[model samples]
Target: MSEKTSTTRRTMLQGIGASLAVGGFSGLTTAAEAEWTTAKTGTDSSLYDVEYTNAGAYAVGAGGVVLERGPTQWTKIVDGGPTGNGNSLYGSDVTDDGDALWFVGSSGAIGEYAVRTGNLNDHSAPMDNTNNYNDVAVTGETGSANVYVAGDSGKIYYSFENGETGTWNYVTPGSGSAIQAIDFHGPRSGHAVDGNGKVFATDDGTTWNPVGLQDANVNFYGVDSDGDGEATVVGGGGMVFHLAESQWTADSTGDKSLLDVEVEDGDGYVVGGGGTVYSVDTTAAKFDELAGSWTAEATPVGQNLKAVVRGPNGAPDVTVGAGGTVLEK
Candidate 1:
């Protein structure tokens, strides 16, 4: 197991004997009515990422702006993030228990925000290197989760003790090529993609081994791991790669570069450039091709969608991106 198992936000609906719900894209004669509403977070700063956990929905981006979606609308929770320097926040993830949200970005700025209380903790610039950090993932209970930060300097930073000072270390997952995305399915296992068309897996959170994609030449952007042997990698040119039975298969959904992907129990969502949205279903036992499993969903805005999470009983409960663009389906 590496970087997130089948127990995601919609893990309940993905349980055995339960019907996994998928979304309907309007203008397509396939599924639901494709109902999407543009949401306002009241900021023009680009929203780099979004997450939907049991705790709630969160969006973070440029200028250290963080927004939390309430029952009525989205509200700004942090003005300049934890750094107070206005550095851009690139990516974020909730703890395994969904009690805290951790975000990382420019100048190695990292912060942990308490979900229930508006409390924010500064945990930035570990190892004294202020290089930009790209994305983050946390595993374990809220306060004790293991922290993993992907760096633009081609290193992966880890802290086993809740990201406290002096507890962090770094590793270059593959050729020091700027790890683009990281996610964990179990407490110690997950996978990472790089800007050089490579994928790496780590079961112990410290030691990493190259997985595949050696012959490709596209920038690997986002990854969603169901296990070490079962995961999804989406990247340049709308490519979607799946790992199953220790073998990898590939397919392209469109021409846009996919920025982020998240899936649980065979249901998932992928977002990218041009506000491209894709609904995923990996329940079929296909041995070769990986096409037709993804359906295009309508985009309410043209801004490039940076990240996505499984929504309430469907795909893309929320997505945030360029210009603070948000969509709720």
Candidate 2:
């Protein structure tokens, strides 16, 4: 999934009213209200990936469970598919039109659901169940499209057309690594991060080249590009890297294990283990702890949050592991 930055802007306008002095009086009313309000859907089950579709918000998690949020609450759409026991749904992304949603999880499970038609198709059969697929990215174009799925053992699979059977191909960019996240800023520019603290990028999605980092101890879990070939990657040990001037530079945030990083409204937020969340000022190359910071908002569920996304209603929604946990801010 692309690390999207919340770009919401707030402004205030003031107005003055005139009053009649002698006989009649006139009054003006002024009120201030927030433009957006965020609220948690309130579910106990572990949610791995949360995405907004034309139908509504959908969250996928362990046990092949997929939850959809309606006008009022969340409902279980699908539960316990053929792959019964899986750790978690690792990746999810919506189609360009928001009419389709794709999800990949442990045990090489890959599936897509039609938001408008209630159609669900499992594409895992062609994968041969060799490795668990941990991430998926869909191109912006529709019909006869391209989709990339990354997984354990440095496996990267591609589908030139919609998953209508027999359109899958494997493209190995690296060896002996687990790809945890992937993102395509455009149809041609894309990036992937692996468990071995390495990043591979490609202009056409078919060919990839390694983009070395400064810290070998940092295993990047997520990456996002700005569609102009410039991108940012974030991962373990509070490490951040920016692709600029045809090079990657490390942007450290004072040694925090940042699990997920997202950009919204031109600002970046990195969330990680120990309830650590840092807000980065990209222009200044500096970050500060959020109001509550780590350890303050750490929930009773002491799990290492693995991934996070901007919530459906514009809040920061995070997913953690150690027992499949989900939190919203």
Candidate 3:
């Protein structure tokens, strides 16, 4: 997602009203088990997004910085940019098998990191549009990879060869709004959300169709699919929408503009401005706005969080955002 929110830090801190506390995990010993730990990511660049790969957790941020979390610490693996002033990497994704890592950013910068050989390369956007590449989603297994990179002006690029050779094909046509994020749960199924509160879905990733909401003016910042025909979308004004049964239902998330959301197993996590982080237990076949399923977790800092991803190997969830903050829980 892009830096669409211009509210300052002080204003955001003052807007953090009462947070809701949901029940703990079943059979958990204590409430302390639901806390987050601050992980030192070294650089102070604001990390826009994160993804898990075989090498570890990789975070992309300002100045084209990419931090890799090792067993003990986070290393600044990639710093500076193809340009001298450094580019802003807005979104990233890794293959399920952890064979490839892809990061998309400003000026159509696409960085591909190979896990096994430790080789990193740069790929240009389709037709070298130079528009800001905001989000990316990778589908298929390791050997056969299809990467979808979305950006401003409703531009979406697809690469069938892991985007290693700087080749791309435009997929989403005539979309003028900025696509903030994209996700794929099945090989031929995926979703993309744009800045104009529009949702696009593709069964083959080559053709796209618009999905309607009750309201068409809410700007969605992030979206994720659980790979079971269930998907969640979050956006400005703390909007939470669940897509199930071929319908969209508006869910409650208070008044915080949720920046990103991720669903794994039967649970989900959302993060947003003013240090808002929520844990959602999605048990209802259909999402309920008033259901007692949302819990507000404590944040170490009051900075705005941009994106979040589930941790690997039972590790804590990783969140990144303003002031170069990184948290694990």
Residue 288, candidate 3: Cα error in Å is 6.9
lDDT ranking, high to low: 1, 3, 2
What is the TM-score of candidate 1? 0.88
Local distance difference test values of all predictions, in order? 0.78, 0.60, 0.71
Worst window of 10 by summed lDDT in candidate 1: 16-25
**Stretches of model 2 off by over 4 angstroms after superposition:** 1-45, 81-87, 141-143, 254-256, 281-302, 311-325
TM-score of 2: 0.75
Candidates 2 and 3 compared: the better one by lDDT is 3
- Please state the error at residue 310 of candidate 2 in Å: 2.5
Model 3 compared with the native: what TM-score?
Answer: 0.84
Candidate 2 positional error at 137, Å: 0.5
Ten-residue region with minimum lDDT total, candidate 3: 16-25
Candidate 2 local Cα displacement, residue 47, angstroms: 2.7
TM-scores for all predictions: 0.88, 0.75, 0.84
Model 1 segments more than 4 A misplaced? 1-34, 285-290, 312-316
> What is the per-residue lDDT of model 1 for residues 11-107, given as tens digits with 9 covering 90 to 100?
4323311122322222222114455568766788899888755445789999999998764567788978797998889999877656688999999
Model 1 residue 58 lDDT? 83
Which candidate leads the pack in TM-score? Answer: 1
Which candidate comes out best when scored by lDDT? Answer: 1
